[model samples]
Target chain A: MKEHATKAAAFIQDEARTNWHDESLWFVRSKRDKAAHGIPEWEQLRELASQIKDHTLSHLDEYLEAFEAKAKENGVTVHWAADAAEHNRIVHSILQEHNARRIVKSKSMLTEECGLNEYLEEQDMEVIDTDLGERIIQLKEEPPSHIVMPAIHLKKEEVGELFHQKLQTKKGATDPQYLTEAARQHLRQSFLQADAAITGVNFAIAETGGVVVCTNEGNADMGTHLAPLQIHCMGIEKILPKAEHLGVFTRLLARSATGQPSTIFTSHHHKAKEGGAMHIVIVDNGRTTQLGRPDFRNSLKCIRCGACMNTCPIYRRSGGHSYDSTVPGPIGSILTPGIDLKKYSGLPFASTLCGSCSDVCPVKIDIHEQLYKWRQIIAEEGHLPTAKKQSMVMAGKVLSRPGWYKMAGKSARWVTRWLPRPLIYNPLNTWGKARELPEAPKESFQEWYRKNRSAS
Target chain B: MSKAHILKAIQAAKPVPCPLPVVPVFEAETPPTREIFGSVAAQSGSRVVRAEDFVGLATAVRTIYPKDISIATPLRAIQSDIDLQQASPADLNGVDVAVIPAQLGVAENGAVWVTEADCVHRVLPFIAQHLVLVLPEDRIVRNMHEAYAQIKIDDTGFGVFIAGPSKTADIEQSLVIGAQGARSLTIILI
Candidate 1:
């Protein structure tokens, strides 16, 4: 795949759509701020959530064992997958045992990470994404652009056209209500006929051996309750030590996500419905690697609220599709590189180190700090592009010697002042491509400081 | 085997154990009130009705919904046109309105806690075109922390905190209520 910058450039070609995308995310961010301001204990909740996650990650092994034992007691099957391939295999085997060919799925980023829908399709099973945004993208044959708002990248007009072709809606209708009603009818049929339901776990409580799934539209409950067999796929990091901790997380989750006081439905599934089977797939998929990094272990504290994405300037302007990961935005920038450093090296550099993402993170993941750290690691591992590496090398040599630095600075100012516009604004000057060079000063700050202070 | 491998990896790579922080019950100057819950519920797209008794709740439900719609309920106080126990998941799909009892009500977000036992069919609360939750005024709590403290969440196979009617903003951030679940939610607090 191409780098994030290349993808971002392509995404920003349509200035009108890019500004709309940016404003839309900022609107959500403003709503989040309003919801957060309503609660006096918002910061306390973030701290408590962070600490609880820290404690849980520290004792993840015990929690997993406890969760597995209790789930077994509740008559639910617990499967562990060290990787995405194994996770998909386990899901397929279970489907084979039940002879289930038709499946309805709620939004699960873990399943997206595993490419479960594609894998199931390869096995000749009919898999449907029940979330309205997810269903739109599934029909459009693309991955979710944002974790929460899967179809945020697509305008209503585009969706209307896609539905016109796929769901046979009116040729040019652009009403979200009409489109949503059509999807509701279309997915309701899938839910009713589904042999199995698959959902993503928002929080898996070790004490209760249950998984909680939150949704604004109640698609997760619609699918899980109607289907005979239910499967909840969760990343290992989703575990919390106790059920009471849910109060802290849930209070923070929706408020941070869509700025709602709460999601429309927060369903807790402890056991299977009567005479039906329940299965929980705990997949690692490089979470342990993230957990091992002390600088990044706090990232596991994420509840996938998508708040960071809403608050991120780069994410808002560039669009989630620009990141080219299952999860896109600040959190994804830090997390994606750990999975494959060479391929995702550009992600950490996508940030401006503005720290807005960290400020807005519900669990207070130091997202920007981690992005900075990842850049260091990438450079140390020689993943930095040659042009950047050579320039940095030249910069370091000049900066280590004051005389050379002075000469270089003086020459740069002279060159900018005297050079022709085309020569200065050439293709090699990527920073100058979109920005005009600042006017050159006759005297440096050091020269001015010496002259001014000498009189004193 | 993967479980063992995963457990071992976690054991080896996990950070030093940290103490879990105490989650405090935030005390506002004034206790959470019914008015707060009602307004919040309205914001979330739910109609909140204050009733004096089950009779009043029944009247409110009847007043809000059309008389010809198919209503399902396990509450003896409210009349039902369909039997929940006999209704299969597919059969529940036809229910126009479902009135169910809530174990507890949360004042902070206008959410009502309903367990599987409250609705005989697990799908009743979601499958219905409109949802009616009868929450006793005395059972309402201040917040999620207080709500979790009072109830046994694991007592039933399934439970949910229903805040409002199902809604989504997936299409260009447009707020559209009644996505795939109930088109409307009416909470009758008695």
Candidate 2:
């Protein structure tokens, strides 16, 4: 019940548009469709990929062990963390060992989930976020709105203001190119001065003992090359069996997430630049419990592609802050429950059950299906209010018995017809401010169907 | 050091044996692509050509750089082909064109991936005033998934995916292409 997150949620709830957010996310999802549909073997490739991921998740312990062995041989030190606090401690210790005062980190949502930046900032270590969008939000000292485009909520003017305040650009100059150049120069100096670099693992190859970090702006390379030590933080689930699998994911990842053919994919191999050291920490905050559950295990196969987020109607409208987790959206709804159910009771109820997220998933993860399962889990745990359960039970009984259903349906139409649109909408829904609700007719569709059936 | 002594010293150096995965034979028969590749195109000012034969290849090469100008090739290529000679300091500074082979190509980013094999000292491309990449059209892939699908572990001794000739947005986000690499590229699709 952190008030900081609640304040963030309130801000997002005020700004999120059902239509625009859904459309924007769907637009990217469709770009993935176009890229994937053009390839006739796309379905087969997805099947192969799903199979590979499924196999890997089932044998994750074996592969992780194999990765640990191979990574050791490659001169990469391995660390394991059972929880976020342990993960943060291990990372901080590594930085301390390097005598690192200043550190540069790319967009690792895992670190964000762990609140590592806040933790380190508390310890008086300056952590600079290098990803352009991440940096924008970082400058503003706010949580990222979206995983891919962290600062998508902010416009260029807002970014200019943030940069002007943080980097101290000349007053009244807010050009994007100029701003980006300033950031590049400023970050370049930071990169050179940084003693260590931290990166999010895009893919961890067990066969090659390497980690792939896909970035569009080359920020990861800038920091990694300049720093003497490179530390990669990944969820235990990111492990892939071999280097060859990088293709299956790299092809589907960016197109699904951002409509790009691929993220400018960069893989770091061996140790950090000759004598430089590399450390990888594998973390399982709640993954073991997730792994034990067959129904929710497939959710772990996510490549961190934002496809589900983009396609989710509720997510687009309510915004990610409403989900109130390291990850958000339909995937987040199910994932949050696994990580912490009581705190995330409202998440499973957030979706419209549209199923577009599952349709657009490159790996064919049944996202909406998991949302449905999470609903059962939540209800079973008595997370739902007693009044809601009673009302739902009454409604279920009335619907199952066709006589009461017809009466209820007729009453619902009659009530909706009398209720003013404004009363039902802006004050309550609030979605109407940005998105329009469909106008319901005077008569119900079921009544029309009933009349037509009798006439035929 | 003489070649014999160097060979003896190389044998005397300790070999650090690490776990190497067995590379499975992958049959990569790339299909013809109509999508434009950026590295090859941007290198040659986004040049597109239709050449089905060797004569067409030569015509395309000569079209970019004249025949009187000697194109710089690698040390091994110079010894094998009499047409190319060992490039000197003058060639490094004055050579107008250099034709090099690429290790891979990614359609995902419109990148033609070349490596140190073509770079020699990472400067062979930079030092040359003008450049030409011998990108076989069939090497193009739609994304990195396909680009990485065909790789063997040993080939990364040194390699890079040259998306386009080195360009930088360092100076006020103005795209000044060919900052450190070749100022101009003429891609000969072989």
DockQ of 1: 0.89
| Pairs of residues at least 3 apart in sequence or in different chains that clash in candidate 2 | A247-B145, B41-B46, B43-B185, B44-B185, B108-B142
Q: Each model's TM-score, in the order given? A: 0.98, 0.75
B107: Cα error in model 1, Å: 0.8
* lDDT of candidate 2 at residue A366, scale 0 to 100: 89
In candidate 1, position B82 carries an lDDT of: 87
DockQ of candidate 2 relative to the true structure: 0.08
Which residue pairs collide in model 1, if any?
Answer: none
Q: Write the per-residue lDDT of candidate 1 for residues A56-105, one digit (tens) a residue.
A: 99999999999999999999999999999999999999999999999999
Per DockQ, the best of the predicted structures is 1
User: Over the stretch A294-397, how does candidate 2's per-residue lDDT look in tens digits?
Assistant: 78877888878888887776676666766777788788888888888888877777778989888877778888999999989888888875666788789889
- Per-residue CA lDDT of model 1 for B1-190, tens digit only, reads 9999999889989999899888887867777788888888899999888776435877788888966378999999878888777778789888899999998988889999999999998889999999999888788778999888888889999999999999999999999999999999999888
TM-score: which candidate is best?
Answer: 1
Q: Indicate the worst ten consecutive residues by lDDT in candidate 1 chain A.
A: A1-10
